[model samples]
Target: MSLKGKRVIVVGGTSGIGLSTAKAFLEEGAQVVIASRSSAKLSEAKQTLGGNVETYELDFRSEENAASLFKKVGEFDHLVITAGEGAMGDFRELPVDQAQTAFNSKFWGQYMTVKAALPYLNKEGSISLTSGVYGKRPAKGASTLAAINSALEGLMRGLAVDLAPIRVNVVSPGIVDTPVYAGMPEEHRKSMFNAIASQLPVGRVAQPEDIAEAYVYLAKNGFTTGTVILIEGGALLS
Candidate 1:
């Protein structure tokens, strides 16, 4: 339950939900390790995290990279993967290569990390993967994202059974205010958030920290596994 002194590794931890999850784990007195593909972003995240955690450069798409990460980390108590690039566009217009890349990066990336970490992961440990609300309540142009998310949740369920005693779960967040949207023009981004907020019962989009808490809960709760904790501003309800 208590995370004090437990080791937690967060993949894709350089920004967005992953970074916030690292911060949250630190707050709970866990020993946190953050990994991502960008060294520069990892450096920035290390600084942002107050330089108290370990940083690893990991492109989970590479089996070697994933293997190297656990080798260097030795062993850890929890593995959280929040790194993924979603592909958006009408299914008809979406390029097959783009969809494949998205799947490789998000779905297979996490898969590879899990495979690499299993031997090094403590038997008491847990694994948390990221999904999205689109898997359940998809909209136009979200076909690829929906498929990827659904696959991840399915994987979680199977893994929980296969890796019994070592819990596996998912955090399926709705739209959150994170750097993933940094490329959007400021006005358009704000407008989009506002428009979505009006429909949600919560009256606002989620912050990365909001979703971060769910990850924390998953790590601390021993009885929960094979579950998808949706922190989506009630988007499915709306």
Candidate 2:
């Protein structure tokens, strides 16, 4: 269970929660490799994560790329995948392409990563994927995200069985303050965050560091598999 000297690959580890999770591993004395689609972000993350962290520029959207990435990574102790494209919009107005983006990125991307990493993963090592609170409880303009996230949770269950001792689980976190909201208008984003913060029992929405710890827990726990570790800010309960 000890993470010291373990090798971990964090897909989407270039920024946000993924980056924070990577930092967590480094601090635990694990050998970390971070992969994402952005070379620039990867470089920046490497600097922020310190020189001990290794990095790879990866496009997990392609199964072949995912496989190739693991081939290069060789063997590892754990895999934490938090990279995905967010698709949110009104269901009635959604285009097929728009909806498919979420499926391709979050769901299928994680699937391919697992498939590829299995051969390289150390027996008993863990894989922690990401889901969301909205998967079980949706709101306006989140139909696509909800469906994709639900699918991911289901995928983790199946993966847990198929992968056996390798162990597979998911972390479903509530809204976190991250760059994922950068696309929103500043005032609107602030107002939305404030509103969510006010409503949550914890009095604040999650931050990347808040969610990152969950990933570490999943990695360290040997008995847990095929489970969804929900870390939402009591949004579902509220």
Candidate 3:
């Protein structure tokens, strides 16, 4: 789908899936804006993208910041939010503050971004949010993540109806090899990823580019809304 002349905003676009999505949109001739909390990362991303791309330093956890950032961003054809924190641990053992922090950063972060951007979005414009496979299927050591993911999906679906002419959807990706997992214990991480890859019918984990196609698809398809597209490499089927 051609996005020539379209203006798109990608929150959390400094790295991983969001960064990949921004590049894809730019390659399609769309004017892209990338927002994140890190100025250093944003600068790096700008240098990497190298064009007329706009960069904004945004802290989604702060409602004021979110509103201000969107206001400064003005209007756009698409708003994609991939900003979130991944908190893994047993719910009972996890600190309440930690869970709340995760929720504030991811769930409410996306909510505030959408709420702020809705008025600025053109008619038939789309809002894409990110969830995860754990939202649909439970996993060990992911209680907080699961809850937040499920909440994000529900938020998008409800907003789809409320937003009406504007579309809302979520992308749920599983086991993508990204820098986010770099902190995991080497041996354990390797085993975990291998196990995940082996279980999938596709015989491999996903990449940022793999899931990026889904985001581009949803953005271009006007009739599709209130849906969560899973890019789990068939892991959901297994």
lDDT (tens digit, per residue) of candidate 1 on 100-149: 99999989999999999999999998999999999999988999999999
lDDT of each: 0.94, 0.91, 0.89
* Model 2 residue 145 CA deviation in Å: 1.0
lDDT of 2 by residue, 43-133 (tens): 9999999999888989998989988888888988999999998788899998989888878898899888888888889997999999898
- What residue runs in model 3 are displaced by over 4 Å at the alpha carbon? 185-187
Candidate 2: where is the Cα deviation over 4 Å? Answer: none
lDDT of 3 by residue, 143-210 (tens): 88999999999988899999988899999999888778888899988898899888999988888889
Clashing pairs in 2: none
Ranking by TM-score: 1, 2, 3
In model 1, the runs with Cα more than 4 Å from the true position are none
